[model samples]
Target: MKIEILGTGCSKCKRLEERTNEAVTELGLEAEVVKVEELDQIMEYGVFKTPGLVVDGEVKESGKVPTVKAIKQLLS
Candidate 1:
């Protein structure tokens, strides 16, 4: 699975990235966690908010940082 964290390196973005990594580790899933810092690339996902989470090319969360448990659910 490809997990994309969309943001311009803000604190929330970093937190989301960390939570996503934790989620993937807890789930024991091999997913590529990429940070999409480029505005053009983030816009491609149609997410206007920072700290967006994309699972397998689909937007799963946005605007706010979700908990590790929530992220695990999203990954599931």
Candidate 2:
């Protein structure tokens, strides 16, 4: 799975990245986690919000940060 964390390297974005890593680690899954900091790239996902989460090229979460447990559930 390709997980993309879309943000502008803000605190919330960093937290989302950390939580995403933790969730993936806990699941024992191998996935490439990418940080999309570029505005053009983020807009490509059609997300106007700062923090967004994409799984397998599909936007799963946007506009807000999700808890690790929630992210884990998404992973599952």
Residue pair clashes in candidate 2:
none
Candidate 1 overall lDDT versus native:
0.95
**lDDT of candidates 1 onward, in order:** 0.95, 0.94
| Reference-based TM-score of each model | 0.97, 0.96
Q: Pick by TM-score: which candidate is best?
A: 1
Spell out the clash pairs found in candidate 1: none
Clashes found in each candidate (C-alpha, N, C closer than 3 A): 0, 0
Residue 39 lDDT, candidate 1, scale 0-100? 98
Residue 60 error for model 1, in Å?
0.3
Q: Can you write out model 1's per-residue Cα lDDT over 1-37, one digit (the tens) per residue?
A: 9999999999999999999999899999998999999
User: For residues 1-76, what per-residue lDDT tens digits would candidate 2 score against the true structure?
Assistant: 9999999999999999999999999999999999999999999989998799999999989988899999999989
| Model 1, position 46: C-alpha lDDT score | 95
